[model samples]
Target: MSDSKSKRLRDPVHGLIVFAETEPLDLLAWELIDTPEFQRLRRIRQLGVSKFTFPGATHTRFAHSVGVFDNARTLTKVISREMKRNEQIFDAPRSEVAIIAALLHDLGHGPFSHTFEGVQESRGVKKRHETWTADIIRNPNGSIRGLLERYRVGFCEEVAKLLEAEDPQDIYHAVVSSSFDADRLDYLRRDKLMTGTGAGAIDFDWLIDNVRVAEIDIGAPEDDEPVNKVSTFCLASKALPAAEQFLLARYTLHQQVYFHKATRCAEHMIGKLLRSISTVANNGKNVEKMTGLRKEHPLIRFFGKNGECVENYLALDDTVIMGSLNALTAASDKTISEVADRLCNRRLYKTLDVADVGHDDGKKRQRQRTITRDFEAEIKAGSVMIDEKASISIYSEIGGDDDRTHKKLHILDGGKPVEISRLSDIIKALEKKEQFTRFYFEKEEDREKAQRKKGQNHD
Candidate 1:
């Protein structure tokens, strides 16, 4: 109850992260981590269905959150040293705001983390986790806001601003949300380690030592004259290789781990299961009796009309959802039971990369449509096409639509702030976005094979 024990955590990625219990700023992180809301993060996995593919990726957002805070703590030390020669100040108040903001940035993620948002959107509750995060932090009735306000008057707003990324060039906000910020830094390493992908090996020590506070070009968009400047973390020229490795690691991990076909299939099942729940809800049936869940169950409340408030959302996490999925295995509705059993038992859908269909894009589309139409009519399982093309590139010479955070991470060369893409061919090449289109469904051949194998094993 008291801050008697040493405020320390044994993180697998970041190692031992210790905070001085006596220091006000350190005390803030310690107290916040102990809150019920923060503790809920332990029930939420960092990678959602990633564990279905990468068995070791069962790590919680709680660990990642702590790691981000550790990164912010490390960056503050860098800020203290790097900004000493500059006009900027890394004071205690801003330092507190930065680290706390990093700690609580992913605070409002729903059940199954990011993928669950898609389910919410389909049902028309379109408010994102960020919106919920702001609501939770600013809410007078919530636990976090009171704790933040107790630290200092109006401190809640300051931390919220950092999370909102109100000022991208502000060094503190940069630490929270910049292109190469602590969130990315911690997750790249933490996810790599947890997923056991052995990808995204960055020079963590080199990056920390090399990142410096600097004023970069901010005039291209806002003014005709390239006169205005903004301050943020810029990479030292020597850390180019390290930065390149970091960027490539993100791409490789996305390809091999984050976008693993099995993981994507598992996530797809979750979305389908939620829709199936909606179907069951729409039918005039005794939902509680059919599903064997309480009238006030998280899933019921979530799918109900005018449902999914902050309190309901908070009450739902990976644990609750997993439990709900298990409960739905007993559901009487044929469609809901089928989807729920598939998810609960890990009989996930299969993926069909569009490239495999044909050499030409037209041929691929034609073959894809043929297979999709055939599968829809022929397969009892979900045979819907999951066509999606997303960019895997992590770096840019010039920032994209969300330009604020991406452009600030410059490379300092020849006493000038240059875009990192200009200095390294690797970075420049990464600027050209790469995309992939893939379809996901279950194959009858594979299903029959699995069933036959199971029968043989029993014999």
Candidate 2:
């Protein structure tokens, strides 16, 4: 497999990512790698519009796919060797599926990444990345399917089963989509490494090594059947700390990096711009209007000659959106142009950190809203936004019999199985901590002016 040696990439997240040269990914995989579907990922920002906040976060799904494949390869090797030692009981077919599932886990992300989908949500569009991923795999003309055919591998079916609801008990799905799935595992590490932020740092090596396959009842609708039983790859008692570390990192990353106010502001701006364009694309205009203009369209172009609207939602990206923002910065529309200019110039909406959540928070929000309304009405400024912080905890309840606790870590202590919570106090704490943060924002000086005027009146 000299070709294996030829397919090495220097990844900023994982140092070096090596492709499988031994089997030399079949024609379908290669086709997928070359297709517009995959190539489009290169143009789609991995963090969506978050780069406006975290400049270094301009990584793409292309790199993330490669990283996931690399991680899956490593984990597969470990699991494969472990199975070989216990060959009498190990399921070889299931192991193969896990490796393949990892390789194609994110096959369906669209342009502009999640931000595009978020924008569509505002416009009554209900596309899910998972569904799109499945459609592309099932497409008869798709390259991924063709590549799998070359390997004599029913790879597309395998990916579908992993993502679809038909095979709820599938181990492949667990490895790819579960709370502790490979996607989350790799992303947590990769995102932290690339962003130079510690929020996503997880003990991936320890967690992977300690993971053990197990079945537990999670109380789904089919609880009476085997499908309700979740096949989870869990950690050992000692590795619970590692699991806690991973969860905390995920929480922190979501709060600090993923949901950072500036990042959210950029996402909001992009979302607004895309929504405006989609409204135009759906106006029954000729599809050719979006032909050469598939990438980015001037905000004015969204309006048809007759002032009708059209939507070519699929042809957008961070760069295209950014380009559009630059163009619209000088648009004739006052609010639209000002928002565009601020986004283009990095003049983000000022964020006020409101912490209290009771009546005091209610008063703060009311005052902020009043200030924002005044600013919009008087100065016509769009820079005011109020950011309130909120957090959501995911991995709580260490010993409850539910899925939250049933997805418990296991340890082979003296060859005997034991729960991880019995070993790690940190995991115990992580289980109960909040995991999400919320922010509210509005224009800056206007809020200050309103507050000053209110103070003067009170005095």
lDDT of 2 by residue, 43-91 (tens): 7767776677677887888788767766766665555555564463555
The digit string of per-residue lDDT tens for model 1 on 1-459 reads 364555889989888898875677778788889888899999999898898888899999899999999898898888888767675565867877888899998898887765777777776768777777887788777788988888899999988776765545477767787766788888889888888877667889998888887777564564555555667788888988888888888778877887677777777778777777765554527877676567788777766666657776788888887887777878877656777888888887666665554456565566555555545654445555464634456552111233454443577898677877778887677675554566665565743443333212210
The count of residue-pair clashes in candidate 2 stands at: 32
Provide the overall lDDT of each model, using Cα atoms, as 2-decimal numbers.
0.74, 0.56
Q: How big is the positional error of residue 253 in model 1, measured in Å on the Cα after superposition? A: 0.9
Best by lDDT: 1
Positional deviation of residue 188's Cα in model 2 after best superposition, in angstroms: 1.3
Q: List where candidate 2 sits over 4 angstroms from the true fold.
A: 1-6, 24-31, 81-97, 165-168, 199-201, 220-227, 284-314, 330-335, 356-390, 394-442, 449-459
* Model 1 misplacement above 4 A: 166-169, 218-229, 279-285, 357-382, 396-409, 443-459
Model 1 lowest lDDT segment of ten: 450-459
